[model samples]
Target: MQTKPTKSIYWGVVRLLGNNFLMAATDEGLCYLQFHDANPAAGVDEGAWSELAKWARAQLPEPNWVEDAEKLQPYILQLEEYLKGLRTTFTLPLDLRGTTFQQSVWRVLHEIPHGETFSYSQVAQELDKSSAVRAVGTAIGANPVLIVVPCHRVVGKDGSLTGYRGGLRNKEKLLLLERAGM
Candidate 1:
């Protein structure tokens, strides 16, 4: 019988800009990060942990989850710096998992300069797949790493804000933060 690989994923909660976020990392590097809860009045959702587990399982058949804030501090600090408009580019290692096409789309997203917004069509064009605008949008939606990957930098062709996993409000805030730095 074949055995599935066992992977240990470290996770922790971080608070920044008055919001909570769930971050996870592997021995390889930081893998997952998402908004835990955007509204404190609604209370923190315990299900966020399970969401992390579900994502981890998708990456590795056997995922061992460990809560280690110290291990995730570097990621947290860099994120804080970015949110505070003190950092523009991320230098930390990222372990992003996705399909080949999705990876290609994400690479384009990374190329988007900080504080600059690119339309979905523009992203597709960057990949030389201008006809794959919808596919590019789907790949951007599936991005696991948020701020570091800069999916928030993608806007509508008309320059309006679009869908974001972290909520449109947070997306707007991130864009504003980046703009403020410039």
Candidate 2:
């Protein structure tokens, strides 16, 4: 049996908008981006590297992770421009890894224009599976790429804020940033 080659995942840390972020990319494209836990008063923490390794082990087969900021510079620049409210759309290639249902849900998320919000039910409807609201929420929560995927745009059906993997505070900030316009 022919074995598939293991893909190398390059990762790095970037501090932006008063928060530290962990970003990883493969030769194919960006695969992961998450907010790192850091005390605002103490600044960036060193534990984020270990967190990345743990995530890699769970997500890939014998993963090879390289710390390369230069490899992730383009993604960082775009994110910076976005957080600064200078860019509305992302052009970076994404290495989205998920089940078919999850990918479909994420595609709907991508279609949601910047500054606009969608409800979990609406996302399910977009998939032609209106009964899967809960499933849609699950997929959104599983989103690996944070701002780049724009999962923060999803809100409760009544327009209330919902859960965000990056925390509700960051979610609110993202929504406010979008509403404020570029």
Candidate 3:
């Protein structure tokens, strides 16, 4: 009982304050996710956001579409727990939307695992480069899923905190949470 048949694109503009969020959902799973700061482009758009709501409906346990305002609850819990130092890993199906090269870089980020950090040069080596350290940095910068993708785990070759879209302050918070055994 589907409609005219276009790919579903669900979205949500989360008021994360210092960590504004944009969550997107698709028919098969949650896709097209990202986060930004308090910029005007970061909030939810009623019409544009409907796609994500529809997509999220498709991913719900119920087969048919229904207004399930609570689908985002679990994700909120996960994030809250993360910030409180009560959680480290996220239990969500992610949709990493990027070009092939970006996806490759993201794959490297995923392998960083939880509570561990790596260097951009190290990631370049893992990708068989040993020299594309700068390129690796750019890819990481373009990452859509922040904490979930674990880009914060990637640092400078000399073990110093590097740049983060959420800012070095938030990055420090994430790293500190992990180092504290959260």
lDDT of each: 0.88, 0.88, 0.69
- TM-scores, all candidates, are 0.92, 0.90, 0.71
Mark the regions of model 1 whose C-alpha exceeds 4 Å error after superposition.
1-5, 38-46
lDDT of 1 by residue, 1-182 (tens): 99777788888777887878888899888999898874543544768767776777777778877878899988988998887778999999889999999999989989999989999999999988899999999999989999999999999999999999999998999999899899
TM-score for candidate 1, residues paired by index: 0.92
Residue range 1-182, candidate 3, lDDT tens digits? 87554544444556553566666554554554455444535456554345445534444433333223266556666776776767767777776666677788898887886778999988999899887888889989877667878899998889999899767987887788788883
Show the colliding residue pairs in model 2.
Answer: none
C-alpha RMSD of candidate 1: 2.3
TM-score of 3: 0.71
Residue 135 C-alpha lDDT in model 3? 85
